[model samples]
Target: MDLGIDRQALVPVVQQIISAVAQWIRNSGASPGTRLPSIRQVALDNLLSQSSVIEAFERMVAQGLLVSKHGSGFVVAQPSVLHEGQWYEGAEREWGAFVDNPMGELKLGCGWLPDAWRESDDISYAIREVTRTDTAGLFNYSTPLGLLALREQLLKRLSQIHIATHLDRILTTAGASHAQDLLIRTLLKAGDCVVVETPGYGNLYRQLAFHGVQLLQVPRTQGGPDLSALEALLQRHRPKCLFINSLYHNPTGTSLNRTVAERLLELAHRENFLIIEEDVFGDLQHASCTRLSALPHDDRVIYVASFSKTLSSALRVGFLSASTVIIAQLASLKTLTGFGTSRFAEAVVTTLLANGTYRKWVQRLRKRLRTQMAATLQVLEDEEWEVFAKPAGGMFLWARPGVGDRSRVQACARRLGVLLSPGALFSPTGEPSDWLRINVAYAADQRALALFRAMGPARSTSTILKTTSV
Candidate 1:
């Protein structure tokens, strides 16, 4: 179970586990036969006693939230009285499919760095140290604004990038997604209008739909959003806000220049709509790029960031920085949602940040990614595929097939145990395109390169694949 288990609850640990799992089932839109993770996996992931996890599962079974089949592990019960609305949709399922992908596949579609790329020793050490020293994190709920220590550390990080802000303006979240969710629930009504990038994060597109918000799709340029289209959208619909990836934007791996950032902020003020700038990839950028929040004289932009991409996605630690008024509102929304982010997650990150290991890890990780990005770009150029743009520095390389039945080529690749991020998922309206998002880290794999040659470029052009170096 990828459920957030609180170990330090005043209630029994088993009860805490039960609450987490039950809430997930109710909200996740899990199907009748959906199988939960094994008791051992859940125990190991959450650092809980195996007996406690087992007890929790048994209680869930009794509560009709789960059922145990003979040797099939715990399954979601039929006729599930889940939360209203479709919480789990196609976009989420797409991301989950990649997560649950079999190791045998060439996972060029994944969002995070591969498991082999992570500093397991450093991460494990942080987890162990936090578990040993921070007894309160294990049992207690996090503060509404999250751990002060973590926020303090984040303040320093923002300073390094010229994003000046105080701790009070920050609110920690489960991840960047959670921070976005909190803002959506807090600021938007069921039928409110909001603007999203045309080729944007699909997960956010689905999430906005879940909230029943009307999304105005703004096309993106290499530098930033198409400003003329954005102005027209604002004039026509007057959306409540505009959600965007500012620095090192996802899929395309492009950052907003200072001129564009200033223009966006001007539009936000004149048009009277908020700007939710998602800087999740900020730390990953090789250069110090200008973020929208850099012009913070007015509180129109809310800065969202995550450690998941740079550190460990499993930790689910992220935060948002905004004016005190906005932070207070979003923090309350967070309280009404999941109480706050995991205390354990906050403590683990705080420890790493305080000791300066977090900085060192990201620095090394960025260097490695820069190397991979260059090699991946070279391979794509050699194959004559059209790249969206050469990334300054980031994980993804959005590219077109240049030739062939894109759908057929994708299907063929998948049959051979290779996964590609289809372009349709990145569009707000699920519009089809020839673009594919490639993960730079995984591009180094010789097997993946061979598969790409044979199943991708080769199939597209009806030519034999060369077995030379990628």
Candidate 2:
């Protein structure tokens, strides 16, 4: 086959063989089922060891580039086509679509921070330390309530935020989404009514819909949810639960005020509905913020938070705090659903938290996000875009062009290879709107700047002021 083997190169011999064989298959016009030279023959022809040849072939087979048949040697495999509908097929997708963007495409609407913003030294060190010190974490499943040490760390964090709770009331899950799913499975049933924000998290809307729950959406205002609208919905339908983002809301970056928090609690008590407060981005805020779970309630509030937003997403560490009764129920469901979260990941997070690495890391992250957010907001203002609210701290800014049509804005973004999170995706009904969720971390990129600048100047100063007053 004349596979090129470079002995002096830094690449290992087995990897080199794998690359050469793949290149040969592509360039030689080899069709499916075409067999290459025997492993022994290739080893002899290339002046290499048979072990290297066998390892390369096995690796190739595992990669779906080749298939091994019983006593027939390896043959080229058919090219695999990923089914479009297998996953991320609908408009409800947010993160999946962001992740699937083409290389070099600017992700201006992504949920998390850019790669350059992530500080990996502490996380990497924690991973290595866990690998060296905790053998049981590597092999065993976490307990029903998750690792005790990790939960203890979480308890300290909760205390900092003033949500006093004991270890029995805390339960760790894969992430906030997993925690939400456990709550849904344990507390809700099909045909139940749940109140959600109108322009809120798309993934949560989809999750609720998947469980056959009817969603009653209340409009989210600059202060918080429109209390009048929420109260009106409560009058007609008796919802079982109300899901809300208490701090740094997903798309708008709005934090709940103390007045709103208290009122929401009162309504929850009167209406006999549970409130699930999601605080995934709460850590990024520098000032103290009101949390629904922190307020006095009759065990009607469940708080879910995760390290995925500020920390490494791959770590998949998150926890929920609630009444001991609710925690016990959710923990049992968590065991049945996924057994438990990764003990290794929990251990790594514990190490980071115990050594104070996580606190210092988030402090730096908060400062960076604050600076980027100011710069991005300035750019938006110069380009005459209308911002929904000027966030105190966090990564998102909800804004739209002040002059151009929605279609023109989208077309310009496409031409500049900029991915945007259109307002429609945030709606529970998939209803279209002009606003877009701009992630400040990527908004400073040249491509995103160009797209925003292409919208031209605002039509009128009065119009711009009226739209952006919130």
Candidate 3:
């Protein structure tokens, strides 16, 4: 029970207690089901408050290190055998674009922001406020449409982007993935043709394939999907839907220009196909950035967005806006599959939005990401890397060395303790590629720079391709 709590250390008392207990259990070879000292006894032995002991115990239980027995107190739980490498075993790794990087490795290709960059104050306040004020949020399931307050806030947000929608057309989801799943289930049948970008979101490709849909990949140009190729596909195949990332497209970091957006809508209307616009990174762009859903023909576009990229990923709150009919269908499917999204998480997001904390935080995030993007681009230029496109604003920067084997580049990344997202994983068919999806947030790290530096400079002018622009 002697945890040797360092009261003067910078780490919190609760965290220290949790670490000490975990280490003790590991070193002493505590078996599963072994009961631990009571909270009162631990507090007394360590000269700490019972609240601190209880919090530490609760955190450990949440981490699966301990199990809280109703009357018997906390006991050790079975140790996990899954290591970080196992998370990316085979196909899982290719589709797991948002998975956390292994400990001590630079997540140069990861989706979310680094832990240090996240603002904890507003989020922490929201969590505390929700827990204190909303009792039902903590215990009950959300309504079919979602928490009313959160939906209202989302509606306001949509209006700012010029996307007009009512509360009945908004449906909360676990995340953008969940929204996509519901849409796929509600609108698509097996063997239906769906148009996806060649270098698109890998997870979406996997999901559509799993649903037994026929994938028709259209080449993605800097401005957006190649209109000529897309038009050709529409003529050749009667696709049921076209999935697209309108703003800050994943991997490529490109946005759809107004001209392309108009053309896409026209095609959707002509081809009799739905357009599922994934705007998860829309908030990170300037307010004036073009969106398909913001256009007058929005009925054909089902808009899906989430706060996971800018806000905390742990807070899996997302929403989709569509025609009332589509929303009703999705809501029913959501209720049947998962009951509903998290009411508590929705409440927390609502609190942040209502108090204007989320708006200010996103503004700050956009500024920081812009700065990082510039720095990372400068470094890539200095290293003579071929950038796919210089995004106006977003977390991703797709680039590759002017000359090198893709396998060698990956091996170099591993040697430098950096994790990278290979471009092949972004392809619909999983074709071999030399391109890489670099996260601007992590590309500035010295470890990431080391990997770039190792690749050396572009060999010749002929080797470098023309940089695409929006």
Q: Which runs of model 2 end up more than 4 angstroms from their true locations?
A: 1-88, 92-94, 458-470
What is the alpha-carbon lDDT of model 1 when measured against the actual structure? 0.79
Q: Residue 302: error of model 1 in Å? A: 0.3
Model 1, 77: alpha-carbon shift in Å? 20
Model 1 — TM-score against the truth?
0.79
Model 1 Cα lDDT, one tens digit per residue, 248-329? 6778888888888898888888878999999887888677678888776488988999988888888999999998998999
> In candidate 1, where is summed lDDT lowest over 10 consecutive residues?
461-470
Instruction: List the candidates ranked by TM-score, beginning with the highest.
Output: 2, 1, 3
TM-score of each: 0.79, 0.79, 0.78
**Residue 330 displacement in candidate 2 (angstroms):** 0.9
lDDT of 3: 0.83
Clashing pairs in 3: none
Q: Compute the lDDT of residue 459 as modeled in candidate 1.
A: 52
In candidate 3, stretches whose alpha carbon ends up further than 4 angstroms from where it belongs are 1-91, 94-102, 458-470
Error of 2 at 39 (Å): 40
